[model samples]
Target: MIQQVFSIVVPLFVIAAVGYFYGSRVRPEMRITNQLIMDVFMPALIFHVMIQEDFYPSQYLPIMLAGVLLMLGSGVIAFGLARLIHLPWRGFVPPAMFSNWANLGLPLYVFSLGDAALGAGVMLVVAGNILCFTIGTYIYSGKLSSLEVLKTPVIVAVILGGAFNFLDIRLPLAFDKSVEMLGQIAIPLMLFSLGVRLTRASWKDSRAGVIMAMFCPMVGVALALLLIELIPMSAMHQNILILFGALPPAVVNFILAEQYQTEPDAVASMVLIGNFFAVISLPVVLFFVLSN
Candidate 1:
């Protein structure tokens, strides 16, 4: 577990450090650069990651379903934690609902378990994205920020990708090759955007935010581990799901908070702190999980 943790963490930290320094150094139109990344680079990466890989899930459906249910279940657990703690309704649910499944969870899964587990993670990510953009947005709208049902990139990406997947259709090889080339830009750019966004925000030691950050992912990681045990799964597959839950807070949480005006600062703090703290927490959770 120590080796596995270091194997993943070391490379990620180095790349993130590079992004931080590079973003600080570059003075070129930041917004334009971000837009280029979001509109072109990241999407290509997502699409490429999904399509280029062979999406075979002979026994993965159950795990995928478990991942979805785990997230929804975590939302309930998170809300209970909040109510018990008695934080304001406005900020509490968003942070809890906005999981770190996509940005942090997916890539790490792909890296750790190869493409098959990543496909499972992708399904979970899509379901989470739907919930985040739709129901979660409903809660945040008129309270924190405006909610537009159709304007989310995650949703758009899923719809297009899913349609093709469901129908078992493939794009032309030439076009697919072109897109694959473009998709290579996704990883570095996604990491770079994260660094740039983090740079723009300032972190404060908000007690409530820190507390929620500690509570939320812990519930998630615990549930995922329990599911791995109770549900019949191979050792390798269980490791994949366990790691997904152990991931840091999703950057989308911060974006939703910023969009809806819920607890952007708090969300930022959760992400900034949650990620840094994951160096310790993830290993702790994964140790019991993997050993079991």
Candidate 2:
């Protein structure tokens, strides 16, 4: 059990650590890299995975619905908590609602649940990304953000990939390989970028960060438990949703905060600390899910 847990986690940390140390010494600029990821690599990955020969959107509808409930439930809970604690809702709620489905989640699910689970993981990510880009962005910047969501590359990819899957359209073999290769770059790059982004977090905001680091997973898991009882699903999906609920905040939360000039520092703190804390949270989650 311990070995399995370590195998899933160690590689992610080691790769992120490489980014952390490199960023510390070189202070490399990441704007262009992040742009490329959002505009090119991540979209490619989403399309490649969704357009796979065996992929079926209908098969994962239960998981997809559960994922939506988990995100919306977390946001509601986080909203009440934010008001109770007087934390800026703008800074706190987004990270609390959107888990690190890409950076920590994709590989984590693959390693822990095996490659067969990748499609489920991808479905969960697509659900969260849709919410994050639409509702999450709206929360940060009001109504105008609606149009922006339409233009987001991730959302665009989801629409196109899902369309291709539904229509039974297949890319030519060589073109398919190219997209797969490009898609392959998204996950590792996401983890490394997470490390680089952590370097800029303000420890002074660690109090709120710590609060969220603990709060996010608890709310998510609670919601997941409730939803699973309400929604019948396969054991594999039940476990996948449970782990998804336990994931840390998405690193993109901080990116969006920065983009909107919200309390970017506070968001960064939550993202950095929440992920650092996941080293503890995830293993416990694994023990629970795997034991059952």
Candidate 3:
């Protein structure tokens, strides 16, 4: 397990580190590349994942409940904590609620569990996406937009991808080939872009806020593990859920923060803080859960 995790995390991180270095060396270029990855490359990748996987809707019911409950529970708990700390509504909600479902969870699902697990994980992401675009956006921006929710990339990806998968409809060979090529770029590009994005973040700034952000995910980790144990999930799926809960704040949070005029910097800081802690926190949490 140790080696498996190391192998999975090491290369992506190494590449991301290199990307950070290059991004630092070339600022504007990196920004453009980040935008491109987020805007175009990522959507293609998501579409591919959505379309290719065979989703088992019945098997996913409990997992879906777990995901949604964690989101809502964590959101309220984190929001309360943030409020206690006197964080503004803008800064308070994003880190508190957003689980790093994208940059972290998806890849970990692919690596740790393989195809079927990845399919289940995709369902989880789809649910997360709906919450993010609709409720999450409202919480962050202090405004409502049903139209934007329907238009969100992740939502669209889920709906369209499900349609394609269920209908057994295949894309044209040419378009499928194109999407595959572009989709392959998603992980590397996003990780690199994340690295580039981190360049502007001060690792030391917002220490208190960062610490506070870690608190909720810890609670979430405990809750998730307990639920897995009590709820009768398969051992492997339980492991996945525990790890998913252990994941750092969602990258989507920071993106939404920027999009909706939330506290982008604070959200970024929470991600940085949560990720730093995750290296130690996840393994220990996993050890405990698995041992149990």
Candidate 4:
């Protein structure tokens, strides 16, 4: 079991560490690289998984619904906590709601559960992406724009991918292989970019960041446990949801915070602190998840 956990976890952090070391030295600009991952690679990953021969939305509908509820429920909990703690909801709630589904989720699922769970993992990511862009944007900006949501490349990928799946359409083998090759770049890039981002994060708000780091996963796992009881799902789905709940805040939360000028420092603190904590939190979650 120890070996299993190490095999699954070490490689990922090692890659991120590489980026961290490089970032500390060179401080590379990743704006365009990040845009390419979001615009090109991530969408390809989503579309490829969605259009897989074995992919079936109906089989995972309950898990998808649970994923949506988990996000909303986490937001409500975070909002209440923010009020209780006298913190700004803009900074606290989004981190609580959005997790590192892309950076951590896809690889974690593939590593822990094997490639069989990849489709389900991607499905959860697609659902989270929709909420992140639509409701998540509204929470940050106070305006919900369907047009804006639709314009997001990941969202568009979900739409087109789902359409292809539902319509029983398949890309040519050559085209599919090309897209898959492109999609393969996204996960490593996400981890490396995450490492670079962490290098730039300020530790001035460490107190709030530490509090949020502890709070977010607790809220998420508690909700996941409750939902697991209420919702009937396969064991694999249950495990996926549980792991999803325990993941650190999405780096995008910091990005959005910076974009909106809504206490970006605090948000960055939460993101960095939460992820650092994940070094402990994730393995603990994996112990239970893999043990079962």
Best by TM-score: 4
* Count of clashing pairs, candidate 2: 0
Backbone clash tally for model 1? 4
lDDT tens digits, residues 1-292, model 2?
Answer: 7787788788988888888888888889998998998899988988998999888888899999999988988888899999999999988888989998887888788878887788899888878888898898887766445576668888899899989988999999999999999988988998898788778766679888999889977888889889999998888898889999999988788878888888988988898889889988988888888878
lDDT of 4: 0.89
- Model 2: CA > 4 A from native: none
> Which residue pairs collide, candidate 1?
100-250, 144-260, 144-261, 145-260
List per-prediction Cα lDDT, in the order shown. 0.66, 0.87, 0.70, 0.89
Candidate number that wins on lDDT, 3 or 4: 4
The deviation in Å at residue 258 for candidate 4 is 0.8
- Count of backbone collisions within predicted model 4: 0
For model 3, the stretches where C-alpha displacement exceeds 4 angstroms are: 29-32, 172-175, 203-205, 229-232, 259-261, 286-292
* Candidate order, lDDT descending: 4, 2, 3, 1
Compared to the true structure, candidate 2 yields what TM-score? Answer: 0.95
Backbone clashes under 3 angstroms, per model: 4, 0, 3, 0
Clashing pairs in 3: 99-250, 100-249, 100-250
Tens digit of lDDT per residue, candidate 4, span 1-292? Answer: 9889889988888888888899999999989998999999999998998898788879989999999999999999889988998899888898998999989888888889988888888888888888888888887888788687788898889889889999999999999999999999998998998898889887878877998889867888888888999999999999999999999998898888888788899999999999999998888888888998
**Scored by Cα lDDT, where does model 3 land?**
0.70
lDDT of 1 by residue, 24-69 (tens): 7873346776667556765665665555437654456667766776
